[model samples]
Target: MAQAAAHTDTQQHPIRLYLVVWGWLFILSACSYLVDYFGLAGYPRWSLILLFMMLKAGLIVAVFMHMAWERLALTYAILVPPLVLMVFVGIMVLEANYTLFSRLAFFVAGS
Candidate 1:
């Protein structure tokens, strides 16, 4: 098990780093709460919320999950499917908008 021992040593699990990351995560969580308390309106609010969410998720994945030191292939395997799904979700949103507009137009014309 010397190989296993050597492999474990390569990953530096410093308490300080964890503390710092935890502090940042806590701050980000507080900021998200502040945004809701302030009643931010419209796209700007959503943009900020999504940005903060992604940042928090990224930090969790990178640090807590230890994906940062992983191989490129493994990293892409874990990340790419969600990215492709997001692309399809965006496309579906556009199609939904078009369908909604058409239905509203047809009903308006009939009335």
Candidate 2:
């Protein structure tokens, strides 16, 4: 049917966009590795690493997954889970510092 053909065309547009996005993602990853291997970054090493990772993730989500076109509720569903895990990571880091410092203080007091 003509409607089915039109529907197929609409689907193809996003697929094409996704393919292009993936191509750029591959290029970015390759370039990031080259930069890292060449030791071109003058600042903190993790800064470049995290920047590339975030950029790659953003492109993957925005173009490949089409999260940029999604509704707010759907976007929140995708984004919130990782944010919860990040909060848990932060809490764990704080707890680790607290425990380590407490043990050190106890050792000092006992001595």
Query: Model 1: how far is 38 from its true place, Å?
Result: 2.1
Candidate 2: residue pairs that collide: none
Query: Superposing all C-alpha atoms, what RMSD in Å does each candidate have to the true structure?
Result: 2.5, 3.4
- In lDDT terms, how accurate is model 1? 0.93
**TM-scores for all candidates?**
0.82, 0.71
Tens-place lDDT per residue, model 1, 16-77, is 98999999999999988888899998998898889999999999999999889789999999
Cα lDDT of model 2 by residue, 24-80, tens digit: 888879867977788775675667777888899999888768888889999999999
Residue 22 deviation, candidate 1, in Å?
0.6
Which ten residues in a row are the worst by lDDT in model 2? 9-18
